[model samples]
Target: MKKIFTINCGSTSTKVAYFEDDKMMCKSSLTITAEQLKEMPKTLDQLEFRTNQVEDFLKENNLDPKDFDIVVSRAGTIPSVPYDGAYEVNELMIASVTYAPEAQHASTLSCLIADKLVKGLDVPVIIYDPTCVDSADEIAKITGIPEITNMPVAHLLNTKMAGITYAESMGKDYKDLNLIIVQLGGGITLGFHDHGRIADWVYDDEGPMSPQRAGAIPTRYLADYCYKSNKTLQEMRMYLCGQSGLVAYFGTQDVRDVEKLIDEGDEKAGLILKAMAYGVAKSIGQLCVVRGGNVDQIILTGGVAYSERITEWIKEKVSFIAPVTVIPGEREMEALAAGGLRVLNNEEQVHPYIYYPKGYSSIEDIINNPNELA
Candidate 1:
């Protein structure tokens, strides 16, 4: 049996799993407190510390790193890669994550830790379906302003895995179906999966509001607030991405707590929850239009998908487009393990990591400088 080790680093926790082929033998997670994060402000700085945690876990579990044939880590927000799949972790990937504009996420340490742990072993380290996966169609890239393009960034890992799982359940090929995947969690991302490629997606920051994210708001109002609110760029980002949504209105980021308030006859909380679902349904409707109304299955996954209230609200608005499949909670770790298993079984090719320089303002620029992508 081929042994694979998978790691997924979230903002506050690191999940490590040992898999023997398709079966997970052991799994563990380490939580980093707010104090620890405050001391190690830079994501790359936590590399050695997090790697030590992984090593400790391996030692406690009586597993030898040398026995593992493959190691896979969740990808961080690197420079936008045009393709998706298992990417061999290399210096280019490490540099891209280390130097990217928004490299503050804990996931940036994934490849770094994996690289250190698998050294001197005949093991391959790979990162699968990073958050920056960009497979947008040409038309999908066009924005209202000529100077700005609609970049593709979303929850590619769980969304794509949910789609593939649903396709398999139907005994259909993932590459032969049109799928609209909605991931409801701390942030919500709605992706239009056309056949196999992700034609377009609403970036979570710009899509439906979630438990912690503000999602989309009126642009004119946002610009005015930026001018008058006297908040720094980082503060504004925190307000929009981390402290907004339910927390901004209800002072709590937990969806279950909000649901409890609703159950206890809080009309306002119920209305806010319904409004979030409505926003999600609206985004689904828009993506259905993007897919020309030929969606085969609408898949819902992530933390909030477990809530029947939210799913019912969304279903009422979108069941007309296609059948809805709810695969509750996250499948990210399993997805990483499955990707490593595929590569181990020779079912998929592992691609080399290459960094594309920033500042390509137009499609014409990309067309003109083909070697830049190389």
Candidate 2:
């Protein structure tokens, strides 16, 4: 029996799961409160603290790190990710992730945590469907501005798995089907799979507004807000991505609460819920044209997909394009384990980690001395 350990590092929490072969043995989530997070101001600083949390969980569950045959990790915005599939974690991956093009995030430390867990053991650590798994075609990458290119920064771990799951359910190969896979969570993303590759996409920031993200807003209005909001750049950033969506109106990201409010006859809540579904359906329609309305299925998967009102609203709008299938909840842990199993069974080709020439090798210098960059 092959033992697999998967780690998904979040903002202030670590989610881990153990699988013996294809069955999940146990799973856990280790969350850190705001006070505890204050101790590690830098993301990398939490590496040791979070790694210890995973160790404790394993120990408490009577699972040893040494006994695991392989370790799988969740990754985010690392320098050019190899998009074909699962990649073996390596030094180049670590170095590039530390350089982090945008803001440094906790999931960037996933490889670090995975490495620590399998320190002395001869185990392979692989990351599956990391953020920024760019597969958009040349035509899809174009923007009106020649200087800028549209890239696919998506919730690929869940979207890809959702497509595969549907393909298998229909007794068809993923490579032969044309699909529009929508990931509805705190942020929403739509990926258009042409054959096996993701040929087009409606990125979270450009697509539907979600529980946390504002998604697409008027460009002129947003540009005006940059000047008139009188808010710091960080605050403005939060407004665009973090503080917008449901949280902006209701101060909560949970759709269950919104639905409860609807149940209580809250008219405003019902309106916002319908608007969310409208935006999702509009994005689905946009992607449908990408393939000339030849889509086989439109699949919805993620936290928000659990909402019957939203999914049904989306289905109501886009059911003409293709049959809509709702597969609720995040399956990141299962996706990671499945990817690892594919690698172990030689069912998929494993790619080597590639580094960005313009990336940093280490954050060690800056971590110890904040003034170094200055």
Candidate 3:
């Protein structure tokens, strides 16, 4: 049996699972409190602390890291990669994630911790369905600005797995269906899957507002507000990503508490929740057009998908397009473990790490000096 150790790091928790072949043996998650996060200067500073927690969990479970045949981690924000699948962890991948331009999340420390745990062992470290999996068509990359191009960033692992699983239930292959997937969690991303490839997806910052993200806003107003507010870049980043959304409106990120207010007859809470669902449904409609209106299934998967109120709202708005399948919760650990098993069993090939420089390559130079400009 192939032994696999999988790690998925979220903003507030680190989830570790042990898998023997396709069966999960054990799983544990360590949550870092807001007070503890306040003490750290940067996300990377928690590397040692989080690694220690992993070690403690392994010890408590009477497990040894060296006994595992392979280590797999949830993918983090890094330089864009072209394909999706298992990628062998290497120094280049680590360096890119460590210095990524976006806000630092706990996932950036995943490979670092995995590499540390498997040091001196022959076991390979792999990352599956990282957030930076870009598969947009050339036409999809065009933007109004000549310098700025749209990039593909979404909850790819769980979203893609949800499509595959749903396709199997219908006795069809994922590659033969046109699917629209919406992932509602701390942030929201809606993806359009054309055949097997993700043709287009709503970037995290450009989709519906979620429990903790601002999502899309008026760009012109944002520019004017930035000039008037005088907030630092870091503060603005937090406002747009971490401190906006429901937290900005209600002073809390917990959806259940928000639901409680609605249950207690809070009119404003009810309206806001309905608005969020409306935004999600609108995004789904737009992506359906992107798929040429041949949508076979619409899948909703994420933490917020558990909310019957939200799902029902979304379904009522978009059920005319196709069947809506609610696969609640982020099934990241299972997806990672399944990816590891596929690679180990030779069902999917493990992709080698290739460093692609930032920015577009020259259109004129196709044959020679391809690496001249990034």
Best by lDDT: 3
Clashing pairs in 1: none
lDDT of 3: 0.84
User: Residue by residue across 59-113, what tens digits does model 2's lDDT show?
Assistant: 8999978788889899755755547578878766654555443544677778889
Note the residue pairs that clash in candidate 3.
none
- Please give me the total number of clashing residue pairs in predicted model 2: 0
Greater lDDT among 1 and 3 belongs to 3
Candidate 2 lDDT: 0.81
Q: Number of the top candidate by TM-score?
A: 3
TM-score of each: 0.90, 0.90, 0.93
**lDDT per residue, candidate 1, 327-355, as tens digits?**
99988888999999899889999988766
Model 3, span 134-163: residue lDDT tens: 787778878899989887788888899889
